[model samples]
Structures are given as C-alpha cells and as structure tokens.
Target chain A: MNSNITHDLAVPLNQEDKAKRAFVTALRVHVLQHMSGSMKNRYEDYVKPEAQKRGNTCDTPEHIHKALKSDFMFKAYSSARTCAQEMVFDVVSDSVDREFETLRAKAKPVAKKGSLTLDDSVEIPKSVSEIDVHLAPGSYHAEYTEEDFATGAVYDNAIEVFSFGQFGKDSNDIGMTLSNYVRLKFPDFKPAKILDAGCTIGHNTLPWAQTFPEAEVTAIDVAAPVLRYGHARAESMGVPVHFRQMDATAMKFEDNTFDVVFSSMFLHELPLKDIHAYLKEAYRVLKPGGLLWQMELPPMNQMPAYDNFYLNWDTYYNNEPFYGTFRRQDYRKLLTDAGFGAEEFMEATMPRYTFVGEEAYKEALSGENTFDTLTGRMDPKGTRWYGFGAWKK
Target chain B: MRRIPRKRRGERNRFFQAEGVDELLSALLRLSAEVSALKDRVYIAEKVLEQQGLNVSDAIEAYELSAEQEAELAANRQRMIETVLAQFDNSSDVDDMTDENSKIEAAA
Candidate 1:
C-alpha cells in the first residue's frame, strides 16, 4: 500500500489525543484479556461447583447468569467491560470533537462523488435507534446536522481501539479474509456487481471492490453519517465504492441485480425477525447462482455449551440484545428456510492471517483445513474467521 | 485545557451498577494526555538544546537529586508504554494463566 493512501485513510489526531487513544486501546485489551480470564476462573472455581452441588444444571446461559451475575468477580468483569466500552467512545469522540467542523466540511465534497448516493427518507428501525449498538454512544445513524459524519469517525477510531489492531491496519481483515475464501472456493466465478449490506464505514466494503476492481461495488446502510463518512473514507483511500443510505431489510435494488451479497459481523446486531427479512432480501437481490456470504459469530448449537454461555455475555450485559438469539439459530437451516437448498449452504472458519501463519493460510485456502467443533468459538484476540451462507440457484 | 465534547445525548449503559468509574477513567486519560504533552515539550526542548551544543547531563550533574527525588523522576520519566504494560506484568490473573497453573485446556 502507498504510504500516502494509508496516511490519508487514517483518522487524524494530534500528539496528546494519540497518546490518550493508545492508552484507552491498551486498557480495553487488558480488561478483555486478563480480567476475562479471572472471570472464567471464578466461574469454574466457585459458581459452577456451587450450582452443581445445589442440584441445578449449569449448562445454559440462564443458569450461568443466575449463579454468577451477583458474584463479585462477575460484577468486576462486567464493570470493567462496560467501562472500557464507554471509554472507547469517550476517547474517540474527544479526539474527533475538536475537528468536528473540518470533518463535516470534508464529507460534503465526498458525497458529491458520482458513485455516492444518499436518501433522506430512509427509515432507521428501533432496533438500531432504541439502543446504542455495541454500546457505542449515538449508535451508527445519528446525525447532529446536515452532512454530519461524526458517528462514523467515532466508530472508525473506536473499532481500532476495540479490536486492538487485529482487524488489519485499516480494519479491513474481515473483508479481505472473506473475499480470499470466495476466490479460492469458486475459482471460475466472476462477480460483476456486488452488494454489501449494513456496511457501516465501508471498511469491509473496500476489500471486495479491490479484489474485483472490474466489478462495481455498492454498499448500503441506513445510517447517513456512516455512508457519508464511508464515501469520504473510500475516496481518501482512492478506492471507488458506491455508498447509499438504505435499509438492509428492505433494499430498493431491483431483483436479480447483484452478483454477490455479503455482510460482516452485521446480522447479530439485528432483531431475529429483521434477520430473516434481511436474509430473504439478500436471496432476492442476488442473481441466480450468485453467492451470499455472511461473516458472523459462530452458531451457538455448534459450540460446546460452556463456550456458548461465555460468548453470550454480550447479549445479556453489553446491550447487544439479539446476539444470543442469532447465534442459537442453525445458519444452514436459516439459509435453507430463506429459499436456498441444503446442498447450496456452506459454512467454514476462514483462516485469519493475523493469527494463522502464512503457510496455514495458504493450506486452508486449498481446502486442507480441518474445522473442529471449537473452531469459530475461540477468543477474538486469537485468529479464525467464522462465516456461513448459501448460493442462490 | 481543551474542552472535549460531552458524550452524545440519550442512552446510558443499563448494565453498570455504579457511576464514577467512567468519570475516573476519563480523568485518568486526560491526565495521561497532559503528561504526554509535557513529554513532547521536553523532547523538543532537549533537541533544541542539543542543536545549540548544550548537554542536559551538565544541569543534572550540577544539582544531584535526593534519593526520593531520583525515584520520583525515574517513575515520571519512564516510557509511557512501559508504565502502561507494567500494570499487566503485575496482574495476578495473567500470572495464573501460565501453562502449569491453567485449569482449563486452551481453546482449540
């Protein structure tokens, strides 16, 4: 990558703000790693044994919560996690707040690009508006004024802080990993039109456009702020991506218009009904034999019961209400229900290059990878990308 | 002394049992930012002094610090990254996760 493109694509912060951002990011990593380990130890050492002795099954999320929520270890873990979540917004928002006028001004010209589109009348469902998704303040869609992109700027910085730099330098790993798998899986397929649903900042959207430069990439989100910011982000990086403010559940695109439909870590944020609607819509938009891939959390049923309980903490305590419900559904069954047959559905844990060695990545691409039951349920700090979807035929 | 923007209006964390932790975290971050600013200023001052062919070590030699002052200076002048990481090094939770002590098998 050109140094200039990489520099321009980064969110700018002065010396002091940069230090604060780095501290907050480090703090988040510490809490998630050390503190999380302590929580698990406490559960195993005390809560589980006590519950089992009391003749209660400690296998389900409800049982675990009942036995552990009041424990001091759980409380500390919850507080630290909540504090880290809130502080991420504080750090990023503080860094960006000083240059709010400048960023808002920068967004205007970017939206004027012929490839960018904004619809003022798009509806933001309550599932998005009623709560801050991922505990982010103001969620993704709120705009303080016309052409405001502050929410997107905050998210772009916060995710980097939250991911601890594991999401690639530009946080484009999810897109890059998924696109690589698509090419390796179907070597002959050439998608001419790709649609990325619920593309917040087009971080993942840019990879598909880069992988298939000849193809036209169109990314849609209901959030105007992110769409505006994503357009500017893509422009700054010199990647041509068409961004639109549109709902994923009911996209305005014509049927059989897209050659590929995809999303990354997007479905679990939505309510169950909306997820089904979105899946049906994704099936409707893709052309016959076009691929529909979703990079998401591992399905709950596929994991050991303890891993399921561990990953479901966010659903209960982090304000991600729909996460548990979404993970519990069989992804293959969901796709088959959405009109694709069982044979058309495929699921795999893609090799995360940042975690896996170069040789392992290449081997996995060649279909030499073995996915055990615990493949996708591992820690985020480690490698492996969980994905599942179906082909429209 | 800069006035950072207040958090966005509406919606608070429903999970937290207490309030002051977020404020404390924010205050610590601001303090870190101020310390970083001072460090940057000191770095530039040192560079400029060096350019003028002056050595900072001469000033330190002229006024030797008491043991207490030396320790305080050492703590204050530690690299920001080292100071941050020292917390992790001191953590009991991290120590207990060693291969010999770990109770559960590592994630597959």
Candidate 2:
C-alpha cells in the first residue's frame, strides 16, 4: 500500500555531500566506539582514583564533570563529537541549499490531501531560538526564504547521519516503537485523533498515521521550515498528517480534543518551566481517558550518578541547556500536578524498533525481554527509548 | 592585513567551548581522504588498463612479486575484509533497503 506522493525519502545529494555523509557516518561510529571508550577508561583509571584520593565523592554529576573535564581523552571525545555533530549538518546543508529554489517550488504546491497551516504570529520560544540546539546552524525555526524548508531538510538528513542508521534508516524509530508499544500493551485502546507535539519534520508522526489508519493524525511544531518540510515529506510518503506551526506550551486546540497526545525527543529541548507548561497544555487538550505519552531521554533518577553525569554532558557542552534540569525532575509528580491521577501514571522503556527486530519487539510488548532495567546504562548498540505518561481521567 | 579569506574557516562547536581538537581532526581527515582517493584512482586505473589488454605491472616494470609477498598481501586483504568490509557490508544492506523505499517514494 504505497501512498503516491512527491519527494524521495532518501534526499537528493550531490557527489561531494555523498562522500561527506559517508565520512561523517564513519566518524560517528569511530567517536562513539573508540573515542568514547577511551574517555570512559580515562575516567575510571585516572580521574576517579584522583578524586577518591582527594576525599571527594565522585558520584554527583558536578564531581564527575570536575574530575573528567581536564582529561585530554575526554576533551578529544567532546571536541570530536561536537565537530561530528556540526559536520552532519554541514554535509547535508549544501545539497539542500543547492536545490533550495526548486525544492521550495515543488513543495509549495504538493497538492496532497494533507494540509499545512503556518501561523506567523506564533513566537519562537527562547529555548529554541536563543541557542542553536544540537549546534545546527540557524536553528529549526529560522526561515531564509518565503518558501523555505531547508532547515527541516537539513535536520532530516543530519539526523540520518547522526544516528548511524540506528533510527530505522528514515529516523522514525521513536515514533514507530512507542506507537507499537501502545498498540500491543493497550490492545483495547484505539485513539481516534492523535497529536504529536514538537514533531520536527514529522519523522515520528507518520508512524501513528500508519499504525492507526482510522485516526486523523495531527503534528505541530513552532518551526515553519520543519512544518512545511514535514507536510511535504508526509505527503510524499502518502501519509495524511495535518502539520501546523503552533506553540506546544499553549496550543490553540479546544479542551478534550485528541485521544492520544504524544511527543518524542522533544521535552528536553524546553526549559523546566516550559516542560510544566507543555504538560499542562497536554492535559488541557486531552479528552477524558485520553493518553498523554512522551518519549524522551530517561530521567536522571532512573540512572546511577555516573550515568547521570555521562548523560548530562549534553546539558553543559552539547547546547541542550535544560537536559540536566529536565531529567532531574520527578516526572510522576509533574503528571499528577498536570491533573493526571497518580494511579494513571506509567513509565516504561521500549527497545528502539531499529535495533531489535519485530520478534523481540513483540516479546518486549508481552512483558518479556524488557530493557527497562538497563536504562541506567545508555547503550547505543542496545538502543532503548524511555517513555512516561498518564491517562487523563 | 588579511585581505583574502582562507578556504577553510575553522568552525567551533558552541558546546565544547574549546578549539584545536576539531581542527586537528579536520586536518587529518583531509589527508585521509586524499589517501583514499589515490587508492581509488589506482584501482580505477588498474581496471581500465585490464580492459585495454595492458596490465599495470607490464607498464610499470616494477620488481617481481615473491610468493611470500603475494601470501602476505592476500592475508592483509583477508584481514581488511574481516575488519572493515564486514561492518560496511552489513550497513549497506540496510542502506539498500532505505534506497529501495526512497525509489518507491520517488516513483509514487
């Protein structure tokens, strides 16, 4: 059942970008495997022992960071990772930039049944606008042209390279895995209207539409470029998704709307205050007995202190300012405060659909071969996404 | 004093908040790419010469390869296949699937 639409899932890249993308892909593997291991060994062998000799408990993120920051291996890994992150964008940016005019023209009149509604008045939040999240130049919302979709294209291609093909080739694992989990676990629950908040380029958004064909799926993001690109991408894939540029903090939807309000890899991008606001908005928009699930980085409380520090490296050095703060929050309390009862709240881990095949995924769904306990140790090879939410009753 | 802009403007990572490391990596990458490109060209040239009924060894007139040299090179090739080609070959299968999907999308 191939939906007929425009555009290719594998973006059109010239020879140079192709080579650069390959280089970036190999470099990511090298950095993650070799360089990351060296850095960890340095911490274990030298940094931790030095801290212990100094009579300091090197358990907290601050203590760990203090001990590891000056280490050369740590510096090399950090720098290489940062460069690789930026290179992911740089390699793809050229291809998108080269075809900007033609791509925009082609996208504007895609003529798919799915719609794209952009509200120019929506203010770009400081968390996204102030810092170039993930060191991506021009951030997500910045529009260089009247019909610009380059930022979204940049992100789409960049993420494919960054994940090293772990995000199910097209970077839809988060959405597909979570949606599949919901389907298997709550077999009786059928969402009529599904909403994906902060859906960048709608990579995760399409899975819901495919998973629940009867449901009318809507995905919203503040970035016009991503929204525009997402709409075209969805149309090209023949998935009908209504993509709108709207603030997640204060959505324009009426009360008791969507049956399933979901987000993926989005909450960490917002400040702690905005996270609360977003949760409240999620509560406001969700109908009675509706599900509000968020798939994001595992909270700090779930992991050991060393793992917390290791994960929080992004907060201090990866341009994600609120990552550390958001992870430390008690999510169960946040859900309860947002009008969800304590009994309704649930937190679980699902293996990324990209790494584990359908059989293991089914095993995970049936409460067998679960990876929730291993959430403390973040493993790229054995990838698992952490999710938490509550039913609005 | 500097009038013309340099070809490679060193870009810094905002998060790392440091320099030199990324710059060094980039520098090394350029040399690595050059080496790889040269190797690629030699393979291409070998193929072209083979098709033209002119062997590269015949043209070059280099020292004769000993049986020991041949065995060592074969061993090196085997090791490379196990180490490098094995990982990439697996990834390429997934990549091919993605490409097929993209082709379908394009056709649609």
Candidate 3:
C-alpha cells in the first residue's frame, strides 16, 4: 500500500489526460529536448502568425482562451506542451556542459578570460552555501566583464531549458488559464503593477499581460539569453512585456512598487534560505495591500501517495535538489513570517476543462491538494488546489 | 514492487517526495556539504601534493581546511543541531507548496 507506486488509478483518465501523460510528457520530451531540428520546426509550426494572432496575449484569460480557438492549434499545443520543459533542459544542459569544459580549461591557470573575463571578486558561489541547489550552474551572480556575464546566463538558461523543455509560449500560457478562474471568481481581481521574477524566456510572464490587460507587466531573470529570447517572443507575439536580467533576491525595483509580485515554478530551484530571502524581498517590494502569489508544486502534507511519488521523481535524479523541499513547506506560515497576516491566505484548484465535473473540487478552499503537482493521482474527489492565499495588510 | 532502503531513503525522497522543508535535515546534510567540499579540496590537494601516497588528512595542509579545522567544524556543527531543533522545532515550511495559485505552466 505504498501510494507512490506507479500506475493510473480507477479514475478514468480521458483523452486529454492520456495525451498529456503518454504522448507529450513521454514521447515529445525526448524529441524536443535531445534532438534539435525536430523541436525547432515543431515550435514554428505550432505558433504560426495566424495562430498567435488568434491567441490573446493582450486580452483577459477568459477571453484569451475563448477567443483563441483553433482545434488544430490547441491540439498542437497539447502535443508540444509537455515537451516544453524537457526541451529547455536538454538544450541548456548540453550547452552548459560544453561551455563549462572551456571555462575550466581556460581558468585552470588563471581566473581570467579575454575582453570577456569577469572581475576579480566575482566568483561562482559554492553550490552548497545554503543547500544543494542544482540542475543549474552559475546560479545568478553579478558579472565583471561582457563575456563572463554572457557565459553565466548561457549556463543558467541551458539548465532551465533542459529542465523546462521547449520554453514554448503556448505552454507558458497555462497561468493565464488560472487567470480565467480568477476572473470568474473575483471579477475585481485586478492589480495595477505586475512583476514576474526569474521569468526566463518570458513565456510564463507574457501570460500576465493577457491576464490583466490594464496592468503594466515586467519580467526579470539573471540570464540575458533567455531575456533576449523572451524579448523577441514578446515582440513577435505582440504581448509588450518588459524583460530584464535580474536576480530575484535583489531585484532592481523600488520598495512597495508592485500590486502583485508573482513567479511560477521558481521557488523550489532556490536554496531554502534563498527562498526565505526571496519571500522577504517580495514582501518588501509589494504595495501595502498587494498580494504575493505563485503557481507551483503542492505541499507535502496534502499530497496523496502517488502524487508524492510524482513530486519526488524530479527531486531525486533530476539535479533539482531543493524542489522537494519547496513543495513540502507550509506556504501560509511562510507568507505570514514574510509579513502577510494570518487567515488571509486562500488556495484553489482551477477546473481542468470547461465541462469537467466539480464534485472533486468542492472542498478546495481549506487547504486541499488541487494546485499541487501530484494532486491528480492522490485526491479521489479531485483536488481544488493546494493553494494558500492572502492579502497584504 | 521493490522498496527503497533506509540508507537510500534520502535519495528516494530527493526524487519522489515533494520538496520537504525539514529543519532536522541539516543534521545529515552537513556530512554531504563536507564531502562535496572535500571533492574539490582533494582534487586540488592531489595536484599540489609534493610526494606520492600522502593520505587525505596529510594532503589537507596543502588545501584550504586542515584536519584540525574539520574537527572544530564538527564541534560547531553539534551546537548548531541543538540550537536548530530548540528554536524552530516544528516551525518547518518544508511541507507546503500551495498558498495562492498564480498563473504558470505547471501540469498540476
């Protein structure tokens, strides 16, 4: 009776679930990540100009998903989406490995490069300063020269792509789907200033522009390559988000400047202490009543056996050392410690499809397992979300 | 099928469990940090070794932290364990992931 045992349960997973798990997650991951041409061609085909024009990167999520309806495009999205993260991981990991070798060979005698050499004090921080932060090298530090700065971002982005897959804009729009639910539930859920930090490739950040068309949206990360890629993506998609290379802990913004500070799947990659620092920083940067939010793995206490197993898979062998730790902590208390008032927190699991039943999600509000990654396999009634919500005091 | 062994439970949890934020984990983790540091130390120490077959402890003088430093580091580690447990006893954020759902591309 170990729940982590792998297999589909009695819950009849439909075609969408099957495609997500079987085809996209499994088959597409290999091609998009390990192979190059196939993924590039597939991405171009999936996001043709016509399809992008139809997709609303500027409308509300409800309108965006509703207005952007092409059966073929949606199907292609489904096909390419799961491979999204896998491809990022493949590309970035391979690039970093090759580049790291060059870095080592060059630095063996002295810690200097040509016109691109980094400053003297600028050193790669030990990976274990706080915890075993991995699946990434060069973990976001200030650069001295032009070349090392580029090298740092290149390594970081490569690991991200390897971990994330293709970094596709369509897949990144999943957050906007939550915006659909938020809009329906709280029609007044509007924030004037939105920040998506550590937003590599800008795919996740662009969804915010669509989610709140009125909000001024900006996305930041330490890697310039992904920022450049994200910028081109924003220009091509016409989403109009400002992308910059910046660290999460020390973002280049004035205090209390944002109504909403959000990040997606970003916390677990950081060391535990770094997570605490980022939370404190988020509290510092948010407006008096601004909300702090994220869409990420569910807590460990709320997870069922199989779901816990699913969450564990990445943490174990994937070089993502801190992911499991991030999922297991009490987010409500964490937010409270960071500054939010108690009992101000809320969690929800948005519906999977327009017609999906509600019985599974009825008890979503009081710390259910909906938003957590493994929620599907564990909670029989279906999870609403492992979400914890709160408003700034 | 097969179960993961206790020796490898940490490894199992690393891969399988949602990231648990156990404060007590730093208890065992210190050893890993030491070993990770040692890997680099040993690599460089061996390179700087003047003679053949010097032990890791003997080679330590050639590197950053000596054997005496490691032992003292171990003592400081003991004090940290008690302090960590006493202060943050049950106040662990290691078990939670859902606060408020934001917009993102998570499969869940």
Backbone clash total, candidate 1: 0
Task: Please give, for residues A1-393, the per-residue lDDT of candidate 3 as tens digits.
Answer: 001111111112232222223222332333222222232233345533444576544222223233323323322232233223333333333433334434333322222111111123322223322222332332334233333333333433433233232222244433553444454556676788888876765556766788788888878765554454445445545676776656677766899998888886777777788788878888888998887777666776666433454445456544577777877788888888888888778665554322242343222322333434324222222323223456777
Residue-wise C-alpha lDDT for candidate 1, range A81-128, written one tens digit per residue: 676677778877876777777665566553333267889899889988
- TM per candidate: 0.81, 0.80, 0.48
The positional error of residue A218 in candidate 3, measured at the CA in angstroms, is 1.3
Off by over 4 Å in 3: A1-169, A352-387, B1-108
Real A-B contacts recovered, model 3: 0.00
Candidate 2 CAPRI category: incorrect
DockQ for candidate 1: 0.13
Local distance difference test, per candidate? 0.74, 0.75, 0.47
Ranking by DockQ: 1, 2, 3
- Reproduced native contacts, each prediction: 0.12, 0.06, 0.00
- Superposed Cα deviation of residue A355, candidate 1 (Å): 5.9
Kindly give the stretch of ten consecutive residues in candidate 2 chain A with the minimal lDDT sum: A1-10
- lDDT of model 3 at position B21: 31
